[model samples]
Target: MTPAVTPAARPRQVRRTLPTEEARDLLELVRELIHKEIVPVADEEEAAARFPREVFRRLSGTGLLSLPYPQEYGGGGQPYQVYLQMLEELAAARLTVGLGVSVHTLACHALAGYGTAGQRAAHLPAMLGGGTLGAYCLSEPASGSDAAALRTRAVRDGDDWVLTGTKAWITHGGIADFYTVFARTGAPGPRGITAFLVPGDAPGLTAAAPERKMGLGGSPTAQVHLDGVRVPDARRIGAEGEGFAIALAALDSGRLGIAACAVGLAQAALDTALWFTAQRHQFGRPVLDFQGLRFMLADMATQIEAGRALYLAAARLRDTGEPFSRQAAMAKLFCTDTAMRVTTDAVQLMGGYGCTSDFPAERYMREAKVLQIVEGTNQIQRMVIARDLAGPPGR
Candidate 1:
């Protein structure tokens, strides 16, 4: 994962209010890791397009990888609010690490949430704390946002199920130790899907070359081909045809992770802008002295603070076991949009320097854009929010 290459002076984040001392300590540990390990090598590794497998292993060992899971399952047992704050800090340092952690957590969701007791006992510990990596396989080349329309087929073959399909846009595709795969097992819609925990090394499982993307270069996004890969019945998560519900539930939480990452990225951009404006000379003084630029900076900071509060409120709702899907969607939508806007303004504030690779402003701007499209696209989030507000579309 690449580190934040904003400036010599690292950006200072606002102090957060935590519910417990342990949560507060966890955040401090994460910050230390970012400073000591991530921030230094981010630019070099990003330019090389290298994936930091070791960094994830370290995160796993530190309990950051499974913070929101239950303690009985070898997880950190922290609340979602605390877990998300950690994500934001990691993302501020580097998106590859932040998004990778989110994707891994999403990959573990199926088994942790819906797997039988026996399955959890068998898999949860290794997944949560054994330094193993995972990939979530739900989207396909043919299906992106329309998840229910996925065409991957899983056929029951005696005690094993043979899965055959290509999963697209999978983070950690080839590198993951396992995959949480959703495939069609019965009819042809959401009701037909089933979730399976497939070992990544299973026969006939392969990953195509990673896609060249506009940003987040250190994170690999690839198409995983499951060519008649076989998984035991023991690995199936939940009952048959219940995968869609599980996937939707996982996404509700996953959206919150994306929101936190967005806020972090925006904060990084804002910090870069702040640093640049203060140092860059204008007609007679620092550019930050100008009213127009100061106003822009003020607006950027306000949007970021608002986005953070929105996501945190949604997280609190989830922690209280209240309905939070609509709020999650709203947070994802607003936070990612805020990231895109703040990063763009950061680039604008830096003038010519921001446009160059010598500075991180342009890179931050590029990275901000993908947040708007990931988890659920901002457009999709709007649809979800609209559905919650007005009952579904023709109602």
Candidate 2:
């Protein structure tokens, strides 16, 4: 008979290589915040299907709301690589919080990258300071992956643009302080789209009741209606017909953010599985002592590490001023798939206990499903990569 072999008493720590002392400190601060604040309340809040608005306010106060933007405009001025690591820590504790930060960053991208000096001076401060949360509005009732097919119209009315249409599947739809909206202003295709910045309190804008989802119910997802909402010309992020470009640019980075979140969720599930495998005993020995179960855990760890590497590499490319869209698509596609697999296996490893809310494995699995669908579905990601490989139209 074999003696029982136990898992190590403590949770295994992940090894990370930080670029600077400041980055190292930033990650430590984030972990402490997660441990003290988020981890304790995550399960309760998730179970009750309640949104944690105050938690975001607290994150803003802690300088975590805008870590990767310019410091002069009230951001933390951290590098993408470092910022992502902090996001990973946040996700491990509570995925809703981590993903919320990513969507906020996406909402700010157009104005930060293309707005005029006056626009930046007037608005970037509040946004990067974390005092305000923003939402991205691109998908319409008729358009999901087919962004160019959107019909939201914005007509120029002298000093203001009047918008009339509905945006669907918007994260932070009702709760955001502002919205980065894309609307059709000219012809029918991508060339006609324009991006605008609209206040949450705009006269003609309203959000529908939140969507009932499989998981991440703590975060709101809703449809926003624009009944002739009006905005001044100065609110436009770029030129009259540049919304498509802006949206794509933002997505390149947003995909990386999603990839990072996937890895973090997977990491959390893996950690839980590891802890359980070590603690639970079976047939005169620890279940983890069995080669089959041990190998399953090993594969989960390997998949997570590979996904992490892919996203980090894409981030590094963005940092170096390289064209990383293809790599970003690849990372998004691969990482999200890995997340689903890892989370499923994690639930499997723990047997019956994994399926209950008593363990996070089931929730992680549900959360992982949506990552593949957001920021353009993994199928769309494949289309993007294949287009790059095969060249444009007839090339």
Candidate 3:
């Protein structure tokens, strides 16, 4: 029987190990590239509300895009812990790029976990190699957090299945080369959902005009419209009614990705604030010289460190093949909340400068809010944790 551990003991039980030398070196390289490449053009892209496809291609060239899948399938095969760190580093540079990576990872998870041998053979290589980008289609206009209420329909007709629906808030709606779509296949609710791998060029598939967003402007978010898009039976990811389980499991891992992004954004905000505080004069000395301001900086650093610890702990649990769903939810909850706090404090430290695009702090603050909402809202995360603590739902 498994030993029972209290909530207080769980952190010690799920602590992370130090990263390998190779992982450290790769992360350092990623940071350097982000500073030199991504940061320089972030403002321009943000102002234009354009998705940087070329930049994604450049990232793909770095082999950073395929870090967590198997080498046999053209992936780098790095552990989830390492992959998440890379995500954190990327997000610290620019949230749009980080979100793009997370969406791609979700798409990869569906193919990796549920794809048939033939499907994997046909698609995994291109996806891992960056020749093909992917998107996840689960949410509809009517189905936000209640994904089970999705109105998308997939009807089996002989050898093909025709799909018709509108998938909203897709991260790479117009740009991805493929999409992992979930559609109604059974009764009503999650048990009826089915997963399919649809090529981007599939007939009758198009993207609606992109949504106007508060942030992540450089990443295009739009609705995907499927009008009788037909896919072969071979394209089905898993058995009918398995899509909900697959999507939830993939999200358990994806929440770790979002947590990493939050940590990175917090770190960026803190780093920017620290640099500015040291340079900006106040009362004939630097702002950092003030004890009151210094204390706030200390708090920001502490929270960011705690957030990192939580997400890394969850990632390690996942990498080790342990039961990490609860841990992942906890990390997502804590890290995103911590990020919101830290970024807000960072903005406060900057006074008027924080509210403008003259610096990135304002953008960081905006991005942090969205992180809390995505991959399941913080309220939903609390319910998940409470349910886990209460044991099984009907017990």
Model 1, 1-395: lDDT tens digits are 12244553455856897999999899889999999999898777876888998999999999999999999999999889999999999998888999999999999999998998999999999999999999999999989999999999999999999999999999998899999999999998899999999998999999999999999989999999999999999999999999999999999999999999999989989998888888888687888899999999999999999999999999999999999999999999999999999999999998878898878788889999989988778999999999999998789
By lDDT, rank the candidates, best first.
Answer: 1, 2, 3
Q: Which residue runs does candidate 1 get wrong by more than 4 Å?
A: 1-8
Go through the candidates in order and give each one's C-alpha lDDT. 0.92, 0.89, 0.85
Cα lDDT tens digits for candidate 2, 212-316: 999899989999999999999999989989999999999999999999899999999899888887767889777889999989999999999999999999899
State the weakest 10-residue window (summed lDDT) of model 3: 5-14
* TM-score of candidate 2 against the unseen true structure: 0.96
- Candidate 3 C-alpha lDDT tens digits along 1-395: 11122111000111225368777777777867776788777767777887878877877777788899888888878999899888887887778998899889888899898898888888898888865678999888999899999999999999999999999999899888999999998999889999999999999999998888888888888999999999999999999999999999999999999999998888888887876677677677888789999999999889888888898888888889999988999999999998899989988987887787777778888889988998799998988898889975788
Any idea what lDDT model 2 has?
A: 0.89
Query: What C-alpha lDDT does candidate 3 achieve relative to the native structure?
Result: 0.85
Tell me the TM-score of model 1: 0.98
* RMSD (CA, Å), each prediction: 2.7, 2.8, 8.3
**Of candidates 3 and 2, the better by lDDT:** 2
Best by TM-score: 1
